[model samples]
Target: MLIPYDQLEPDTLTSLIEDFVSRDGTDNGDDTPQETRVLRVRHALSKGQAVIFFDLESQQCQLMPKHAVPKEFFD
Candidate 1:
């Protein structure tokens, strides 16, 4: 489901973004500071360039680029 970013608690949003940026291959060794990475994601979310999706089956949350969300997810 498409959960609006504004609905998430501040701490929850921060943690989610931190987890995403912490992934092994996520940054491609850019070595950006954690806060900077988190801010980048925050900006993307605010601008509609990215979204947070919740999978019904797995009950998992995923951070994905706006164009990359599968069509079925929206249905």
Candidate 2:
């Protein structure tokens, strides 16, 4: 269940945007694309777990139990 960031639901996009911004430690209250990393699925884990690598730095974004990614994409 992988999806392009742009294809995410409005609310889902909001959540990810908030998370990304918060994690980056910026609260300027502006949504701007600053050469962000986009994860690509490498492997699928059991029970919805997955191993994704994004960016040249190899950043990982995992969707846990409580937080589930929708199933309809390959990005």
Candidate 3:
């Protein structure tokens, strides 16, 4: 269930980006990196084509084509 990053809706797209940045276990203080990076890499899926990366630790990327994540989870 792999999806190109561009296919995600705006909200879901934001969530996914946040998930990726946070998944690496790195924190950027009080700033939200996804807000900036999502805009930067939004075209990655269009020009270079980005693929969702999934592993044992996270389940969101593993389940594509399904909006399994709720907005509250991110809050």
lDDT of each: 0.92, 0.39, 0.53
Q: Who is ahead in lDDT, 1 or 3? A: 1
TM-score of each: 0.91, 0.30, 0.44
Better of 1 and 2 by TM-score: 1
Q: Which ranges of candidate 3 are over 4 A from the true structure?
A: 25-34, 53-59, 62-75
Ranking by lDDT: 1, 3, 2
Query: Over the stretch 4-70, how does candidate 1's per-residue lDDT look in tens digits?
Result: 9999999999999999999989989797898999999999999999999998999999899989998
* Backbone-clash count (model 3): 0
Ten-residue segment with the worst summed lDDT in candidate 1? 66-75
Pairs that clash in candidate 1: none
Separate clash counts for every candidate: 0, 0, 0
lDDT of 1 at 50: 97
Order candidates by TM-score, high to low. Answer: 1, 3, 2
Best by lDDT: 1
Residue 3 lDDT in candidate 1: 87
Task: Specify the poorest-scoring 10-residue window by lDDT in model 3.
Answer: 62-71
The per-prediction CA RMSD against the true structure, in angstroms, equals 1.3, 12.8, 10.5
